[model samples]
Target: MTDAAAPTPSNVVFVGAVATASVLLSAALACATPFAALAALSVIALPRPQALLAVGTAWLLNQIVGFGLLGYPADVVTLGWGLAIGGAALLAVPAADMAGRQAPVARTLAGLLGAFAAYEAALALAALALPGSAGAYAPAVVVRLFLINLATLAAALALRALAETLVHRHARAA
Candidate 1:
């Protein structure tokens, strides 16, 4: 048999555990901030299942933190945010996957930017769905999300690059 050379299951578990902790901690932080969970940003670079896992757990933890521990009102605005952020995860993940396959830097950047746009669109749709929450989208809120998403996209891309570099280095060393 060709000797197995890839990471073992235990390695996967270790990585997964670390990633989960990171996501959950980020989600906890998100509960206090104007930004969505940074977990949502990381999902852009992950595969679909992992993306779902990361974002879903983060969302759940965020709700627990915001509603359970902090006593944030479970109002339509809050609910709209949760749903909209989930929708944004769904909308942006595909763009991140596409970015992996895209060759040109321009195409990759476009894909990431498209993810940001998709997130905004999804958030808008969610707000519109809530009867009174649409008015909450004041200019300041819009600008803040726009800026946050910009930073999120940049961080996600940087993390992806770092992962790739590490993988490449490992391969070369092997």
Candidate 2:
């Protein structure tokens, strides 16, 4: 049997849109792609398996855009950092899912914060093992990253809401 349940059409669309957006974001922001925001949104809006798929798609697309389009160094250290980011993104999914379950009223915000914390923590741990990585963890850098994630999450939510409203209006018209 397959490990994941069949994805709904909306889930497929969500994953595709998020992954595409992530690739574009990575092209612009490189290492500062808002993975925590994507992960949190996925977990908050989808089932566990679909959430994993969404986050994984975003991470994979970011890596492709980074290495293929953006010309990231094809070195061991760079590859290690990519893997670390993927791992952190994956970790954020579960953290956000758990927080969303616990706080229904503020599920989205709680999930976003939880996912960001987990993602940063995982990256910090990875930095300890990778030379020259600790500099990225400086307070100023972390704050900037957090702001990026927060803004991305807010924008994603707004876009999703707008999309839903448009779809509903179209359905009514039809």
Candidate 3:
């Protein structure tokens, strides 16, 4: 676990990218912000404190986009769901971290799956309390959301790898 208050330059970039991507994803996917994917990436690519910060920043940006720009309802039910989603995203960081620790070779995949499971479980629990949310948990809906998260994770990982490769090549040339 890295120091919670200290953020390395790379970590700052990672968190900023995640936060910006969250807003973009919210615009493109509506309610699907890919928190699980972000959580998994954060845990796998960052120190523990940075991972938490990354996911939390993403969640906060999503909410801002949702309520501020997207005009989500201001009612209690809507607020409850928002809170639930934020809580789930926060929970996913530790879930991914714990699972990734257990799987050395396939840590990213393990983290992704662990984060997704935790994210869904948290939302399911919320659905039980909030009305009209059960539909979001339908089998087909769940599968679609899972696929979205999986794709997000794959693309993010690819981008990170590409960036690292470019940086290394540039350093070698220099």
Q: Which residue pairs come into collision in candidate 3?
A: none
1-174 in candidate 1: lDDT tens per residue?
A: 123434455434433643554454445455323223243343333445555555555556556766777676788777877677666756665644555555555554565566656656776677666665544468887676656655654665676679779989999999
Candidate 3 on 40-130: residue-level lDDT in tens? 9888778878888888888888888889999999899988998999999999999888874555548888888889999999999998899
* Per-model TM-score on C-alpha atoms: 0.58, 0.93, 0.93
Query: Which stretches of candidate 3 lie above 4 Å from their native place?
Result: 1-5, 102-105
Q: Output the lDDT of residue 81, model 2.
A: 91
The worst-scoring run of ten residues by lDDT in candidate 1 lies at 31-40
C-alpha RMSD between model 2 and the true structure: 1.9
TM-score: model 1 vs. ground truth: 0.58
Between candidates 1 and 2, name the one with more favorable TM-score.
Answer: 2
Candidate 2, residue 144: lDDT? 98
The candidate, 1 or 3, that scores higher on lDDT is 3
* CA lDDT for candidate 2: 0.87
Per-residue lDDT over 49-148 for candidate 2, one digit per residue giving the tens place of the 0 to 100 score: 8888889989999999989998989999999999999999999999888773466548888888889999999998998898667578789999999999
- Please identify model 2 stretches exceeding 4 Å from their true place: 1-4, 102-105
